[model samples]
Target: MTTHLIDKIAWIHLADGRVLSTRSHGRDRYYLPGGKREAGESDLDTLVREAKEELTVDLDPFTATFLGEFRAQADAHPDGIEVRMRCYESAYQGRIQASAEIAEVVWLTYADRHLTSPVDQIIFDHLHDQGRL
Candidate 1:
């Protein structure tokens, strides 16, 4: 089985203690605002770039803090593939408008994470356990 490291960022917007999230261009489920890292890109770089592309907002890389990493059997892709997600916390600039690969941006709470990916369920569990939810 070939394992792929799906490096990603959480891009949490802590406004009134709520987290911002979004859905992919053609998907119905909601997801954290981020995406897979490109070649030669650092985690922070991926976060900033993906955020800008998907949300049309610039991320403060310096303000990005490592959150937690998550691993789960790939649900969206084929079976037997593991996806490793590296999450992060960052402060964003400008209004979040869905631009590139995103459909709609929404602020989510712990209760609203049920529609997230399988791997994200684990991340949400951890965040809840850490009292960050």
Candidate 2:
């Protein structure tokens, strides 16, 4: 059996009970504004780079804090492929505009849960129950 394991990092940027999400080009579902780490990069490095590349924001490393980690079957991947998502709560600068492969950026609330991936749904549930989503 082949194991498809993906290690990814994500950001949970919240404001007024909504979370920031991005829709990549040619993708229907919305995801948090981060991605897989490059070789030899720390979580913080990946966070900074992905945020800029995808959302044109510069994440403030000093204000970063771990939120939670989640895992689920990878969407759009073959069976047996799983994704481990490590998330963080952090502050950022610069006006957030879609960059790179990102096509749109939106703020989502609990009512918008179905638009996200399985792992992101878990985050939405947690944040909603905590009065944040």
Candidate 3:
């Protein structure tokens, strides 16, 4: 099977025991705030760029902390490819707003696992194992 490296960052805003998530345009499932890295871009750069494009918010790279790496199949794609998602936690400025790429924003609790994307499900699993859920 072919594998693709997808560097992703999760902006975990834990407030009132919930996590913030976003739905991209034309995508049904909700995901943690993040995107893939462009060529020659660092992991932090990708997170910052994706957050700006999708959420219309600026992420403080300095405040960004590396969480952990996740590997999963790209279930949303036609080809059965694998993806490596590099997760992170960070602080940002401005209210959450959906931009051209994003359709909606929501805060989900750990109990709402069914609403997340396949990859996000794995993330939730890890978070739960770590007692962060």
Model 3, 77-127: lDDT tens digits are 655666677888888888789887788999888899888877788888887
State which candidate, 1 or 3, has the greater lDDT.
3
Q: Give the Å error, residue 44, model 1.
A: 1.0
Clashes of 3: 0
Per-residue lDDT tens digits for candidate 1, residues 1-133, read 6676555656656565466778887787787778877889998888898889888899999888888788887667777777788888887789889886777888777797778888877877887787877
Which regions of candidate 1 fall more than 4 Å away from where they truly are?
A: 1-4
lDDT of 2 at 104: 94
- Model 2: CA > 4 A from native: none
**TM-score between candidate 2 and the true structure:** 0.95
Q: What's the distance in Å from true for residue 68, model 2?
A: 0.7
lDDT of each: 0.79, 0.90, 0.79
Better of 1 and 2 by lDDT: 2
The alpha-carbon lDDT assigned to residue 93 of candidate 2 equals 94
Which of candidates 2 and 3 is the stronger one according to lDDT? 2
lDDT of 2 by residue, 2-83 (tens): 7888999999999998899999999999998899989999999999999999988899999999988888888888889988
